[model samples]
Target chain A: MIRIGIPRALLYYQYYPMWKTFFQELGAEVVLSSPTTQTMLSSGASRVVADTCLPVKVFCGHVLSLVKECDYIFIPAIRSVQRRVYNCAKFLGLPDMTKAVIPESPPILDIDIDVNKGKRVLYQAIYKLGRHFTWDPLKVRRASIAAWQAHLNYRELMSSHSLTPPQAIEKMLGSSEVEPKTHSSHSTSTQGTIAIIGHPYLLYDEHINHRLIHRLEQAGNKVLTPEMLTTEELESAIVKLVGRAYWTYEEEVVGAGGHYLESRIGGVIGIMAFGCGPDSLMMDVVRRQAARLNTTPFMSLTLEEHTAEAGVVTRLEAFLDMIYRRKRKQVEVCV
Target chain B: MKTYLGIDVGSVTTKFAVLDENNELVTNIYLPTQGKPIEMVQQGLKQIKQQLSNGADICGVATTGSARYLAGVIVGADLVKNEITSQAVAALQYIPQVQTVIEIGGQDSKIIIIRDGIVTDFGMNTVCAAGTGSFLDHQALRLNMNIEELSRRALDSQTPVRIAGRCTVFAESDMVHKQQMGHRTEDILYGLCQALVRNYLNNVGMGKDIQPPIVFQGGVAFNQAIVKALREELNNEIIVPPHHEVMGAIGAALLVHEEMVNSQNGSKFKGFEVSEIKYHTSSFECKACPNLCEIAQLSINGQVLAQWGGRCDLWERSQSR
Candidate 1:
């Protein structure tokens, strides 16, 4: 069986089940690199540019981890997830960056996921990828439809169950039992809810965000994220800024942030990469919207290779304490 | 007599405070950390023991500051909280109507915005030593005077010269240029204070709703010149509370008091004998891979307590219990 490697980094949470089902249907064994670890992070950092945000560096590390394990490392050039609004430069040039950095890398299988040219162009790209395994056109079409169904199911599971991207992926892969992975639920303050708005990569990468949702939950506060809400809810939250958002992730974060603000969740934490372009602009929009809300406490955490866990914990505790006190005060006032 | 103990182990200083059952201050100790947080905390415990004796039994203990987790493990704290919350809590206790808090420690500075006795917003300086107490300390050393004398000299300035305070490196050069241009030492010192205040406002205090009844607390609160500079900058009356140097410790104690009251179980405090428990820290360079992460292990009596501070993480972060 020809083993095709997939690094569990950027777009992995968003597109993995689709990619996995596509290749598996085409009779290729799909091998995913293990969940990100400290080894991968340091290795990735040593290979990437100094100013690159943490997720990109982590992606570099993931590629390196797959160099010796598989026949071809699949790093598709994802230019556009939707029409008009293209991916950041990092995603567009990931395959090239991987090749330039890791001289001893494996043969890379690339497919341009650009729908800007139309639906035929997208099918052509998928056909080219399928031809690497088999020359049958009908087989490729069947695999493509299956992959699309799988991707749709993956997204549906997330919203219906309020599962994080990782949890939903785990359930789909049957790597874990199809059960909701719950954290501390015995908190004294049910009103102290926190909405953590960030990209799937940052939100799910334990090595990147350091299990931030877990930390918040364990600290006697309930946690919420952008992926938990439906598209209609998220869109309605940021209807005021319809044409302003350009990036897909930015829209999700800013819209979710707007919802959390109006919902008056105890707090809204906007996690962004230190040097990310879209996230920085998105965070500014979220901050401005939060400022007007005034009822909810807002915090923006910038993640980098140099981020200190102690410092992050300190800020999180302070934010939680503040919100907790405010909620308690409101309760007292009602009495 | 029941007492609550609070220890704040910062990067530059270690502080301990004791509170009576009524939440009134009993005694406090402040000492330079000197990169030895464990020893400083133990030493602080010893001093507190001498001051209070065994007559007043410590019922609950809490830890705060940068080394809060470490101190919590060492002292067997009932509660462990971050410095920002601790500082805000202490300030609220000191001044009931305080709307803002300006906290400047040696290596860090933060501004906390409060409304109706609750913290609304906060901003912390990111990796900048400028406008912090350490920069002023460095400048004072260059002037060949102690911090107290420098504060006194700055207060005596008739005409303060303007100096840029965005970066410590730039601020030092600007001060030298002013000195070369025949500006008086007192004027230049006060000017540096004003510049630091300006930097604080621009960096840490920016975009926040800063209002009156601002309480300035931290180790740097003792500097009358900085307080005066803050007053002139904000054009609001700045009140420096008593025992400001150990406000983080005081806040921790206050929090522990609340915890002890709420809990049905007895406190987790390990007792005053922990002051004599010597801690041992061992470090070894691991060249396992190209990363070469040097792991440090902290222990008491040759038993590993916790491991941290590596180029890479050999340090598995366990869930906080």
Candidate 2:
């Protein structure tokens, strides 16, 4: 069986289920890279230029880890997921970047995905990708349908139950009984809700973020993420905040940010990679919206490869203290 | 005779404050951290112990600052709070109507927005220390002048030259260029202050509202030039409360006082004799995972008292066992 490698970084959180299902249905075994760690991040950081965003660096690291484990590495150049709504340039050049950085790696399976080119081009690209493993077009069609179903189901699980992508993916692939592992002490003592608005990669990668969601959960505060919000809700929020959304993942940052700020949540924290152009602009929009609203408290955390966890801990602790204090004051007034 | 003790162990300085039963300041001690937090904490404790009246009982203790966790473990604190909360609490206590707090410590600067005694929003400098007290200290050392002289000289400037403050490296070069250009020492010093204020406002105070009655505190509060620059930029009065340098410790002390009264628990303070406990700390690379986290251990007489710094809390939890 042809073993296909998938680096569990970048759009892995968004498209892993579909990719895994599609490859498996094509009779190819899918191998995922190991979870991120300090060594992996450092190696990835070393492979790329110093100024590249952290997620891309992490992607390089993941790709490097998979060189010995699989026959071919799948790297897609995803330009735009919506008409006129584009991805970051780094993502557009991802396949070429990986090929350039690690010339000794296995043969790469590359594809260009641009929704702005229309639906037929997108389907044709997937079909061409499928031709590598199988000759039958009917088999390819069936596999694509199955992949679509898996993707929809994965997204539904995330939105319906407020599960992080990894958690939802685990539940979908394993047993539905898989529950989000929460600390025993915090299982029943949720004091407030905190909305963390950021890209799915930054929000779910425990290593890069210093286990941000786990830390918040351990502190007895419920966490909400962009994955947990619906597309309509996010789109409507974007419309309300800036009259439109232009970035591909604007829904995750600006839309979720504007919506969360207007809601009764205790606070909103925006996390962004240090050199991500799209995130910097979108996060700024959220920050400005938070400032204008003056209702939900906002804090922005910039993630870099070499940032110490101590800085993140201090900010989180202080932000939580602010939230709890404000909640207590509100309780006092009501009483 | 009951008192609450607050210890703030920062990157550049460690401070200790003792508050009487009525929240009145009884005694305070400030000393440079000198790149040795444990020694500075012990030294500050020793100084504060000597200054306090014999019968003043330390009934509660709290710790705050970057090294709050380490200090809490060493001193047996009842609360370990972040510097932001401590600063805000202290600011609110000093000026009841304070709406904003601009605190520039040794290696960090923060702007806190408070409304109705609640911290509604706050920001800390991210991955940069260009406008902090350390930069000023660095420049002072380069110019062969003490920090006090730097402050006094900055006040005497009539025309200040603009220096780029976005990066400390650039700022130093700009200062050197201005000096060679024969600009007066006072004008150059005040220019650096103005540049730092601009950096602080643009970075830490980016999107937050800065309404007056603003309170400024922290080690950098002692710089009259920075305060004057802040006043000019905001066109609002910047209030520097009494004991601004030790406000974090005072705030920690105030928090512990409130906590002890409400919880009805005996103080967890290890006592002033904590100065003589003969504590030591060491770190090792943790090989339990690929992350290779550097774990720190605190010990007394070769017995491990606490452990921390591992990405996983394995060593930290093992200490309790």
Candidate 3:
């Protein structure tokens, strides 16, 4: 069986279920690069230019790791996941960037996921991807349907439950008797909730964000994230904006940020990667909205490869304390 | 009289401040850390005890700065806060109407923006020390002059030369080149100051909505040349509050006062007796995986006190601290 390597960065959290199911249906063994590490970050940082965001640098390292293991490495050139919205420029240029940086890597299988050129273009891209493994078009169609269903189910599972993408993926992949990994939830805790708005790559990548969700939970505050909301809710939260945001993934973060502003949550925290253009724009929008409402406390953390854990922890603890003190002051005013 | 003590164990200095129950500064001390934070803190503790009158009630204690965690466990702080929050609180205490705080320490510089008496936004310098006090200190050393002399000499310059200060490495070479180009030392000093201010505004203070009534604190506030450059760059009068060098300790003290008043708890202060406790810190490389994380272990004599700095907390959990 042909081994298909997938770098565990960027679109890995978004389309892993679909790709894994599709390749497994076609009898190809799927190999995922391990969770990010300091070594990987250093290697990635050394290879790429200084200004590349932490996630992309991490992506380079993951690709480099998978090169020696698998026959073919997968790093999709994702332009758009939905109509009228484009991914970051880096995402669109990912395939070419990989080739330029790695140079000695195994052959990369590229897929165009843009819906702007219509649905048929997407199908054609998938068909081209399937041709590498088998010559049957009918088999590819069936595999595509299964992949699509797996993606929908995965989305449903994550939205309905407060599961990080990695945890949800694990739940989907595990056998019949195995249970979903227990996320340290705040549902039982009486403390005030904090809504975190960020991409799945930052939220689920524990190494990058320093297990921020778990840190919040341990600080006696409930945590809410963008991944916890369904598509319908996400859309409604974003409808207040004049039009769809230019960046696709950031629209979801802004929408969730909007929702959290009107929510009973004590604060709003945004974890953005350092030097992310789309996030900076989206975060500015969220900051303006939060400023206008002036109810929920807002904190924005820019995480890079060298962002110290102590610094993050200190800020988080201080923010939590500020919220707690503000809540108490509010109670005092009421009484 | 009741007292609240705050200790700020910074990268380059250790500071201690005691505040009365009425939120008045009683006494404060500043000493060089010199790569021995624990000893400096202990010496500071001993000095503070001697200064205070007998029967002064110690209400609460707080720790702030980079080494706050270790200090908290050592001195048994009632509260531990980030330097940003501590400094903001201290700034607000000094200048109630202050909207902006520009703090430059030894190795770090931070900008804090306040709105209606709350820290709305803040930014810290990342990957660069050009905008901080140590950068100037290093330059002063290279010029065979003390930091205070550098500041005084800089004030004598009529026409200041511009030194590139985007980075420490770049700024040093640029300074050397300017020296070879027949520029006066005082002129170059002012140029260095201006360069640092420019780098700070462009980097740490970028895109920040900097309002007036700005209060500049931290160790670098003592450098009049940098302050002059900052005032000229912003075109506003910069107020350097009294006790600016030890504002972090003052802030931590003020925070402890508030926390004690609200929580109404007895202080966990290890007392001035902490000076007797011999603290030792050592590091070992964890051979887990390819990433060899250097885990630091703090011990009190033969007993392991705390373990920190590993990606995984397997060793952190190994010790109670």
Q: Best-fitting candidate, measured by DockQ?
A: 2
True contacts kept of each: 0.56, 0.85, 0.24
lDDT of each: 0.85, 0.90, 0.86
Calculate DockQ per candidate and list them: 0.47, 0.82, 0.39
User: If chain B of candidate 2 is superposed on the true chain B, what is its TM-score?
Assistant: 0.98
Question: Which of 1 and 2 is ahead in lDDT?
Answer: 2
lDDT of 3 by residue, B1-321 (tens): 999998999998898999998888999999999988888888999999999999787889899998997888788889888998899889999999999999999988889888767776778877567889899999999989999999999999999998899988888999899899999988999999999999999998986889999999989999999999999999999999999988999999998898889898888898889999888889999987666788888888768878888776567774333
As a whole number from 0 to 100, the lDDT of residue B205 in candidate 1 is: 88
Q: Write the per-residue lDDT of candidate 3 for residues A1-335, one digit (tens) a residue.
A: 89999988888888899999999888899988888877887888889987889999999988888888998988789888877887888999998899999998899899888899998899999999999888999999999999999999988888888876777888898732122223534446557888889897898787889878777876777777787788777777777853566778754578899888898788999889989988888888888888788788888888987788987887787787667766776687799
**Model 1 agreement with the true structure over A211-324: per-residue lDDT tens digits:** 687778767777788888887778777677555456755556888888878885678998888899988888888888788878778999888877776667778888888888
Query: Tens digit of lDDT per residue, candidate 2, span B248-310?
Result: 999999999999999999987787788888888889999987989988999999998998898
Q: lDDT at A261 for candidate 3? A: 86
Which portions of model 3 miss their true places by more than 4 Å?
A: A46-52, A67-69, A96-107, A175-190, A232-242, A262-264, A291-293, B173-184, B261-264, B288-290, B318-321
Clashing pairs in 3: none
Per-candidate clash tally: 0, 0, 0
Residue B126 lDDT, candidate 1, scale 0-100: 78
Name the docking class for model 1. Answer: acceptable
